[model samples]
Target: MKKLYNIALCYQGITEDKSKVSNYITYIEDFKAQIKYIINLGYRLVFPKEFYNWYKNNNFLKQDICMIRFEGGLKSIMPAIVWLIENKLFFGISIIASREKSGVPEEGYLSWDELNGILGSGFCEIISHSYNLKNFDLAKQGNNIISVPVLELPAYFDNGLNLYLKGDSVPYFDRTIVESAKAFPIIGTDINTNNLIKSSIQFITPKSFDGVLLRLWACLAYPVSTGYNAQIRVSINQEEVYSGDFNAISYPGNIQWPEMEFVTINFNKEFYFEQGKKYNIEFETLNIGNSSFRVYAINNGDNNIILKTSFLNGDNLDGLVPCIIIGDGSGSSWTLEQYSNYVNRDCEQFRGATNKYLKYKKDITQYAYPYGAYLANKDGNSISSVLTDVLSKNGFLGGFTVYPSRIYDNRESEYIIPSIAVYGNRSNDIILNNISAYIGQLFEEIDLKNIIWQGILGYDEEDFVESNKLNIIGVTKIENYKKKYKSQLLFKDIDLEEVRNQDLSVIVNGYDGININCNTNADLNYIVDLSNMFKRYRKKLELTINIKIFDTQMTNFSFINFFNILNNCFLFNFKVINNNKNNFSNSVDSLIKIVNNICTTKEKQKIMISYNTDSIFNQSNNISELSLNEAIIKAIQLGVKIQSDNIDYFYTANNISCFMNTSNGLNKLSNKIKQNGLGGISLY
Candidate 1:
């Protein structure tokens, strides 16, 4: 026993003249022919509903069962139902009817009673196409033209309705007649040529079924109009399928009669059509006025063939090529990963099947997997849900968030906070911002200041210098400057012997004075050692540093070198002292001047500076109270403020005083500087 699959043959019937053949004769002929073809092919025909139920239960014999669907009007389907029941061919069938004319009183041919009688027989099922096949396109183009009642009005100038002095009732046949008829409800009246013209026109053709195979298919028809000398031409596959002209002939008395004439063209020949192949249908019209046209192609056939062909040919699903999937973790739930995998898998399956059944040879290309794990959480809770929800609200996808689990320690649970992760793609920033806004809504109670953020500071490729050269230049120049000024400085020639010989016990008793007296050579040496230690301490307190290469041009190589220098400087806890001197007001002045100069230079735009508290506390207001080393650091921070061209180059200072106090104790407290109110970076 071969497994049988159910197949449904769907067909639609349309009339160029619905009034002339208002019964089901035309549809019955086509349906009977379709049924006979299926039976001849050794398949049993069954109704659609029964076939569905049978397939759901037993999966139907793959090659033995088929179903037929006749889609059109009730008038066209009623006769087929009678024929099926009378013949005792209790096979399954479904009827789809146009809802618009179904309830109309059938004229002499088939009344509404007869139509219902056939449907009540239960031989066929009825499906609605639509309440009315609305043609908004025609209504929009018609622009308030009235329809007339041409069929009911008399033909001559009799007592019924008259037009003019010529004793002709032609005025009754004008637009007014059609408009007046349209005003009345069309319940039981007979549809005439004029009525059909007023309503929307639907064109049908044999090639309509080719939509299953062709990438492009269209229908063309000239709508009803009062225009003179109008024609419509249509062609399929470069061959003319339809062409016709319309004209309103005027009788002798300077009077006009409104009439509608129509012609239809259909492609009857079979042509090998394939998916993704370019197909063209051209429409041309001339000598028409104030008229509109519409074309529609109804497709009902086996589309699996086209889908399969496209799959085998590697014509990506709907023309979207698969791309790489980035980020970590399982790709199961990621839509991007899933979509890409589906395409790749389909291609692979197609290749395997082709090799076995069609002997076709093809190589499967591998796609690259994405990098990084989608951080599930940066803190304790899953941030994925929050991030995803935020992205959805903002109408964007593909934004990333740093997972709490990836970066934070469980011990720091209280401080664990998710920071919005931004990708390298600039196009996704707005979406990420929206996501940030959404996350803000959920954690409204938490202080944003407690959260820590990580961001990359991109360097300008051109401004970067080689690390070795930059270090050599900066060190050599500073050394040279120091050598040139060493003798002229005030502190260089101070006599140590005389000061060390004097007693210093009295000064030691006070908290404000220097603790060691320098009266002897040993005491002087001690003082110098203490100053050196303080210098080292100040170096450690410098949080931000900048280097300027005057002669160097910014380039990729230069930036690489600059970054290397920055990393080394940060590691060694040393600040690069700027040697620029012309702009100095005090020790702090020299640093500030250099900072301002660097900020103004376009080549050094990527340089960044962060504040260290020791340096910030040594500004001019507190300089008198600071030791020599403390003043140096305070000058550095002030210099940064003076020279910074934009706030983007500044990094916020982190308070590490608590850690310092715990590690070093009271001796460290003596040197602590108080922070004065200074406005930092603006958050907004």
Candidate 2:
């Protein structure tokens, strides 16, 4: 009897994974280098199907072969797999057979065409890793039950009742074909079982609109991890609308954090909104496994935009790739604990596998057998949940509370700071002050604080500023400054430690405008250079950026470039000002939408919902107060919170327009903001 010695050592990403983004394939190059090194040790490469074929034909290993198993997905991992297939060596391959077949294909999963491409070569054969690649978790939210998705797939469509895609719906993971799994292959056995399972799709139309309805969508969830195919059918008013495969995956047990994804259906025709009309949507599921899913959430009304289309590209490979060992006669009855031995033993299969090819290498592989086999605990009693943790272990004090005292009389004014004075270079300086004074007068008539700012707005023509320069002289008591400036100016105290070359470092917030122009470019490089040269001597200098939508000069290429470069760079409480008054409410709405399109939900924190009150809200105390209703005010506040974890409402005491002058308008706005969950407000 001839003895067989074939070693297949694999390091799967899903086994020892490290990534921040759930659905992104991050360190593939690093993994490729290490895996290829092991293969060059004179061992042959084999895949799942090849292994099964060998077990059927060769019975036991008689030749030197190394098998490489990869999880299934189309374009998400095509580039790397394509490169491997083009290699001269014969290698085995595999993918998760569970993918969308009926409804619109979910983004990032393997498509049929990509799978065919993988199987196109005689050297490769794909094995079934799983059927419904999900580890289901169902929990009751009060009385209703909800389940997180099996795979960590970030979605694009944000659907809700009375909400839909407002514009032309964008398609992603488009024009891709994928293979559907017919049956599941059990591990450690040659048995294959054909399964037929069923599920459902739930769809909702947001509102009645006379315009063209762009998109219809529903979320899909898979509970079983079998490698069987699933399909879904959708209908509106009992009429079949879409019937296709569920965009499911295999071996969902490998995913660390899974997110449910929405399947998109394009409805490009106009539809009428019914005040009392009911639209019925139905979803039917067909599967070979006992796998099931839940589709919820009904949306209608206005549409929304999902930016950052590249997420659909699939460069970020997610999902799990399993590793199984065969060949030995005792491999069949391996216990659950013994599987770890297979993981450890295969890692030891490194014998003649490393020879002259290893001559160029100086480093040795660190053996940590069975690494990352344990389940991680990121939810349920995490570190963030600990409340009674120690804070002072140094033996100073415990069980005590203290705060800084504002009653301190010691004043430190020995430092020689430069004086602040305005250099009236522009003829618009005096006119600017007059406009500011009038706005202040208007605020005085209202019940709110009379304080505003001259946000440093940029211009196209040689950096035209709305106000003059800010020359700092010295520091004084906060109350003294309030007495001196009255309701004319409001400014935030900034830390000047990071400021270097600038001549003026410190300036009191005069509650007035202090606009400046950088007649230069708006590129990131330009901003860096400007910061390096003209440093502001303050920390937490949240500059209020100006937006002039209709101003042709404001649309200068440079100004637009600054914004284009930093699309998602706004803080939660980001400050922006608009001087337009003609369409005050509409202007605010549009600006909020812009912020929504540019930022991600996670990135939105501590947002500031500000109303510049320039010329738009400039009305009599009573009139401006009544212009907007309670619902509108609450909507403004809710909008900010929807896009951010934290939010606040800010209104300038004075601006180009004295809209705050409306007697109770600003006060009512403040109250409504609080009612709608705005965190804080700036008092003039």
Candidate 3:
């Protein structure tokens, strides 16, 4: 059984002065009794350094343990701590190193001398809560935006007409009036005609577009001798889009018989157009003298397109279309980048200050993030990298997050160790109940297959080893295996190289253990491509993946999540291994309890536990498939390091338990072993 433990945080002590008493403060009497009750419950009280040492060496305790931690330098808590020491109990104290060292002890906070005296007693472990209470000042958020150029989508719309071709030109005709209609006519060079007020051409926008409308061009020829300006109004479904005017001199043309060109009216605003939508484009001629312009167009094969003069429809001038084009010229685009120099600099400053403080004292090396602020900036942008660097550079082995989570040596990094909070006002029963619950919760999350059991067989313990144990063999370097064995196949083998040739689903359906060894990002990408290929044919895969991660892999959260998502595909029944080989063991009872509580019969077959005194990859008969408990016992019979010598320790460690951070560069984790000598009640 993996011994389950907790780190309890107490802030202040119940004092006669109501001002000093808070919800977090415990009555000195209740606190002392709670400590005694915990001890009576068989939990060994471990100091901060001891706990850290056991964790680092994988020398987990065979018995239940607890580490009580006190936060702040509040003076009222001194008596309770003294009571604990006088009774030979141990606990830890986390202090803000930046607090005034010369302050009077009675002024609510402990002075340097008082804190040192307590430490001298050899009962209290001191750690850093932070340099100061607020860690946000250590790093400011960076949220400024920087711009970069990006490609822009094309912005021209063609109205589905071959306007490049022009129709036959119309001569100067008489006053042929037409009824009120959505049409317009343009007399050839008519500057004296007061009858026609506005000339309009209707066309549809060819595609959806969004951009500034800089210029509108029309295929027309006009007499510039009159020197009068012309107006062009564009609208979509009766909604005005653009209205502008232009003079002949603006285009620099001849006074008489000016050449036909794509004359444009410049627009100062933007417009949006939808594809296949009808638009009414109207044009007007402001004749100051006897001057006019001729309208040219392509053949109107479809009657759906209309050209009109507001006064008289050009019935004589049939089968003609207007040529118009819109342009948005010399436009630029922007892409934004977020800035975080302020955050980086602040983290650097914190590192410098923290190192300077630790240079002389060297007693405190661990820090608890104030309000969990070091996880991110106020803007919620992750600054974990910066904080991690700062902590590492300052020689901190670990940091605390107060995040209320069970700490697994394999899951959380050393920098961001999670801690749970303890209540001070609870009854003895309630406190014990909470402790039991914490232990159960912690046990439930232990990964059973990863534990390492190391021991050589004892003379009397040989009965635990079964000679007929089943061994599910593992194979690697499959190319070599296939070449050496060829047609002389004796047993089934999992060949990973086949994945590159065959479909992933086909391979998975044909084999049990799917070995995916990814050494770099490229290999990970290959695995991703294989998974994508599998998705094309099936919705799910019943797979057993043994993914091997090298040093360059699994360090990233993204990489872990990728495996997590893949595990989801296997219904979360997948095995993952990294470069680190030192495996830690939990109690056998914890594993059995986990299986009994959650796993079904089918899951039992998939739960693989490896036990070998030599190499885990050894091909000798040393590999055996004893039951989970028997295997653990067999490992113990060999020379495996366990938590305790008392066999009953495994059975009772799960009972009512209790669960520190301080400085000396220490972090605490708990219970990792089993023995059969000390008899206890069989909870199993």
Candidate 4:
């Protein structure tokens, strides 16, 4: 049985009542009592740093320890120091102060001078209670001013005063400046009563700790009173090993109730613990009041068990394995002398070995064994193609090779095994080719049972039939035919011709059309011109006008010249089939010239022209066949007749041409005719 050492008694809720003077005195008395109790338990009071170092280096006997704390500011100063010094008690004393309004202060709830005196006494260690007892900064607006000394307060006051005197109101004090001051080397705010008591007990009474002679199996602490019910759960390496509970109680008429108590639950089960891993024990309160808890542990049992387990479990294996090579060079073009030298060099570089060339030859002659050879390359070609060929020819099992690049690029590296060549870049075609050649050479030397070739292609081209034709397997970027030919199409000459025609039609119909109308001007002088027309001999019926004009002369005339001629013509009947202004009369002659010049095998013209339907007699005629010059002249003649009697007309032609062929030929032609018709011709 291990001798138990009671270390500390963790406490909570000491300074609560600010209005009751006696409550403050009672809290101070309870603080002193806790110190006396630990000393009686035969445990020396130790600072956190001291205890931590000792626990780490020495074996702690199984004993109870105590860590005492109070909540809120000091209702009364702590007397633990005077009591311990006078009585010479053999227990550890730690005072955790809760900075909360209802928690304790670490420096015995004393003034700065008083705290320093306690520190000078060397009987106690002071943890922190946040400067503000009520934690005002973290709370809603309150009357309590936080007492934590702000390191930058002086500087802030200076700046704020300057600004205030300059007619500027100062904003709230800077939080950053306060936080920086607190973080300064000597300005760390002590843990408030809440954290101090919680952390102290949790430190000494760890649910589990490890050392040479002792090991803590399990521990649980809880208040022993009603009203406040708190439970702490502890575990080692994620295993729920221990738990305990504490309850709060009320003391009738006794301000120093001593109602707070704890219970430690321990597990006797044996477990092998390892070092340098995280272990945790958590405390959760079922009911709110105030409480403190701690956990402790010792070292015992065989430490070597963990190390042995690690070794037997095979947790240290990684990296590549070495391979042996065997082969002969009789069937290969390269002589045994050259091949052996190459094998030896590669083997040494890769930290490998191969059978002796001379001894191998002897073995082959004596026992009818086959030749053994090895080849190495960084490119995948040697192993993928060349080795397969060589082994098949020689009728012997070939040695393995590796492709470094394939492995690096996460390609099919396994294919390089049990073959002619080794590592190489799979992405480079040259590397692949070299691997193929190397395997081919190997096959010539040895008669392999069956040869397998591995080839890689692009992802999109993975299904490429060509890659399969070369005895290669697996998809890669360059080998997938679908990807290789994604943007390409195959078509016959007839299909292309059809497409060309369709394109031409779209341009003719989808675009606007130009209309030109020719009319005769009979007015002599602006006044009484009707008298001159009345004197004319009988109006000529069926006027037979012989108009001889060159294609260029009619179509190439400027807009002014063309319209002028139409104004001068007598009873001209011409109609345009399209209305696009870009193709107006000015370029009609140039268009005709271009059409006549297009002398393809199919005898097709490519000129785009439009005419007005109102200028022609028949608006529903397909005039695509009309020459450019004829189209313009006919339109002019129709325009003149329509103007004289207000009667609509149309034009007709065949084999008309347009620029480029498209898929909308019929619609384009219809639009051209409609645009140039007398009054937008009906489909009929």
Candidate 5:
């Protein structure tokens, strides 16, 4: 067994309050307990090569630990991560998965050198947190009129048709801060969160029509724990016609951008109207608690309704940059060159600040740990999404984590991890064919090898979904899609290279590993069928299966058949989640029981304890989960594997102070690994 162990996490969350420099150094020294400390190379560039030399000279890093997270884009953090690899202070880098041409801000990603350098590090492993396109903040969202060009002004609406308005009288909910969204000043009436607000407008119809389409652009005033459904009433010419409710997303903090939606009020058929008819429009919504919504009127007179709600689009505010942190007073209008200059200057300012802080720092000297690229995404970025192909071409990507509904089998990767994401996964449940089709869409052109096809069933969200907070509140209905992989193999895309290259040396793969909460006869049949298929393609594809049948519900399968089936597959990974984990402990009797029943000589090497979705601080639960470092030591003793030894799933900065600079805060994460030995750990 490997001797060394430690908890892994980025130090971004660590914060120290008002304290003397000496106390701060002592706090930093407490981190010496972590077997491996993954440092964040945020705006400040810590050239690992130079830092590594200094540490080595000072007898630092006598033990193996400390991976670096190049948090932003490669151009910003590459020099540091690469320098670490060159100096032999090699460790894995976390990667953000980039989906599209990248979010507009190119400064937030890594380059080929930084990626290649992490790959070159012999002691490193790259775990992509998740793929993201960073789809927010690109387009301007506001009143429809403001989105239209100035040349297209004076637009009008008659009956249901939009026409040019010669003159019109309408009122606006808010208009002064119209173009800006960052400053959300939605106008409305409120008296201690209990007030009803009404709005009205008058228009002259240019032509007659049977019925008219009315669109309302508005936003909610309050953030809540749950969604709020506002009761709204609409009237035409002071006559009530429609009343209904629409669900509004919670803002959580009673704060939001200025964006509003175009809600339509469509009649079943046209309500007859004559040409040049005068009409009045009135609208009101019930305000419950601190929930109120803001509505913005477009400059145009048209109020046409649509079949569905549409987002209002506006031009990018004239001279604003996302990262430059432009204050309200700063005027807008940035050329590409100007934005780039701001980014460069911002980086230098941060770097300079970091140098001044680190000078003569005692805790900075206690333990200097260098990390590879850290991949989870925030600030509108997924750094690893675009790096997938790069890693695969270099033969470094080890596995893929994808939805069970969507198969992402990377032929070059050593493993493929699947998870369930259907809180209400989708309104529709996918069939086996749909699963196969989704798989083909992703792995169409990749070459295949003796790849062991391993898949994970549903588990707790972010450790399975995104962010520990459950995006979906219920179990996915993929139960039908569950325990059904073998029948879908016929649909596996044929890897032409694998066909031509395999005739000389045939490799074998283990049978399928079907993970579930509780084992079922149906799942057993699925596993056995996969076993037989592998037997036929034994020479062509050495497929190994990893069954995780004990996350939520334990299997009651007869040990005789389960033993044979478990042996048939190469590995079995299991997980369970607690919404509230304040009471979790490392030494759970149930975990021991599961290991006793599942761990066999043949499966010992294949067994992997998931190193994802764990709370660094203690939690409350009957079967409290183990902290990363505790689990690593326990896994070694029990003879199993742990994935993502570093912190892999965290969202929000709420718990940052807990890990920042308190003497008892982050040091609790270092654990015994620092005092005992050093080793390697991996996580999904």
Candidate 6:
């Protein structure tokens, strides 16, 4: 039996001329034909409740399921709903709650009572589209034209580097004034022609300020009594800003430390330095007479604070850059604060919608981003973690974006599930054919091997796949497993010579998993470079990544973002470890929920739940032995596999014929596993 495909089809109005938006709006006759055509294709129309329930339960259906979603909660959609009710079909409506209060007939918006009536029919499942879709759309586009009252001051970051409030001023001096004993040659007139120094420091302007000034500590190595005619020039982006005779410069001495003398070179003319723009400050000094000056380079730890510092002639003192200070401009900070406040208020409106939906006894668990906009600001930055956090808090399990793809195995996040747009501009044949093509494409892409068709919906694993032999056997040490299992082995430490001699099929981590520290930028860059490498490689090699969560309380969003970066790079196999507490079910349940929330449905099937037999049997006397077996079986049925270190535990504890040593036990265990459609496991 072919595995059934899940398709979520969304439509707008049923009327031909309901609104100006013709993208999703289909005529009444056209929608009727589309439904009939879908029904003819052996598709079962499910309400949102049923669809989400099936998805949450990990219940893959044997027959294709179609979820009909209507947007805007328009009155014109009601006529189609009547036809759906008469035909005994199920559908969902995404309501713009703000429009419901107005209940404008000309606008085609439905009243709350009307929506409740449709809900009572048991044919319609309602979800919040948004509080005010219009305003949300405008705000997402970086417009400040919102009807709702907004916060006065919003939190803004300092040039997208530091988070700051409205009152917080941008730091004048970027790095700490740590003076180094060593000095670089800035002006050496006493020496040869090569002694002329050219030094430059490039910095990204942290914020818009009144004036720009470059200050660095400089001391005369050899002071000339007379005829000190050295020319000193300061240029901003190659344009000269300051020029003077070296002897004419006034050096201010520190009160406590007289040797810590510094020269402040103020620009002769005020140059407008835009916020976030990189500017180069060049200091060129030529020797005309006998005068020698050396600039004291400061050793600052923060390399990111100031971008780059270079000395052409001397040692490349990377982080030891000059100090740049800007004049105070708190007013400009307030302008940035206003924009931040506007964006926050827009996010707050999402929460407002969640609150309003509770009045109708409907908790919105899903969101369809208006206009399919996922960006938080006008500049297309990374997908808004702030916005996703808000939606996650508001009970949104996931949101859909019209990215024109099937719900892929490697998705961005639960917040950015891709959906294909079905425009009413096309004919019913074309729309239905397009959906069919998507299903076919998905089947070809996510090709499940040895599938058992008849038992697709049942927890009986036999209905999913037909395989008695283990596909992958993983071990910490290959020498032990290779001599025993004698087949495909995934190893942490691979012996290339042993592999060649034994003719063993070995799976090694694409990027040595042990070396990865996801928290560090260097490790992340390594993964990125590897991804690009794999993308460019001509031949396909099986790429596998191993991720162990040592810190259970670690922030998941960072991991989510990391996985998003490696979305198409590799397939992840999860090995769930049950600690010595003997509470295996809790660990299994928690990991399952985490995987479900983080991974797409297709990826979920690829996940393998590994159990350390030592942890479970260490205190097996007090453990719920039967419950452990049940938990393992449940995980297997949910498309998760169990890889135990000891194969004897299943035979001894559960009294099952799973002992690999005996042919009867191995055959029975393998049959049970094949029948249940469990993802292949590894026994170390």
Lowest summed-lDDT stretch of 10 residues in model 3? 658-667
- Which sequence of candidate numbers ranks them by lDDT, best first? 6, 3, 5, 2, 1, 4
Model 1 C-alpha lDDT per residue in residues 1-684, reported as the tens digit of each score: 211123443333322333323212233444455456446546676654454444334442444555444433334444565666776553321211112223443232333345445545555443222111111100001222122211111111112101111232422122212211111110111122222111111122212123211111111212222233445454545765445653333421111113221112333343333434444444445332442332121122312111111011111222111110111111112243332333233234433332333221222111110111222344524424433342233322222112211111111221112222221111222322222222111011211121121111122111111111111211211112113322342121123344345543322232222212122113322433433443443321111222222112233234344333333221111122212121111322343344344333332222222112122222223322222122222222221121221110111223211100010111111111111111111000
lDDT of candidate 5? 0.30
Model 6 lDDT, residue 517, Cα = 16
Alpha-carbon deviation at 355 in model 2, angstroms: 44
In angstroms, the error of model 3 at 363 is 2.0
- What ordering of candidates by TM-score runs from best to worst? 6, 3, 5, 2, 1, 4
Of 1 and 3, which scores higher on TM-score?
A: 3
lDDT tens digits, residue span 5-88, model 4: 222222222332433323123343444543543355444555433433333344443333332322222424344445555664
What value does the lDDT take at residue 81 in candidate 4? 46
Candidate 5 Cα outliers beyond 4 Å, as residue runs: 1-159, 163-195, 210-212, 219-229, 252-261, 266-270, 286-292, 297-684
Which stretches in model 6 have alpha-carbon errors above 4 Å?
A: 16-21, 53-58, 102-106, 135-360, 376-383, 408-412, 441-684
Q: Pairing residues by index, what is the TM-score of model 4?
A: 0.18
Reference-based lDDT, each prediction: 0.26, 0.29, 0.40, 0.25, 0.30, 0.46
Clashes of each: 48, 93, 24, 169, 65, 5
List all candidate RMSDs to the true structure. Answer: 32.5, 27.9, 29.2, 41.6, 19.3, 26.0
**True-structure RMSD for candidate 1:** 32.5
Candidates 3 and 5, the one with greater lDDT: 3
lDDT of 1 at 555: 37
| Cα-lDDT of candidate 1 | 0.26
lDDT of 4: 0.25
What alpha-carbon RMSD in Å does predicted model 4 have with respect to the real structure? 41.6
Question: TM-score of predicted model 2?
Answer: 0.22
User: Candidate 3 at 174: error in angstroms?
Assistant: 89
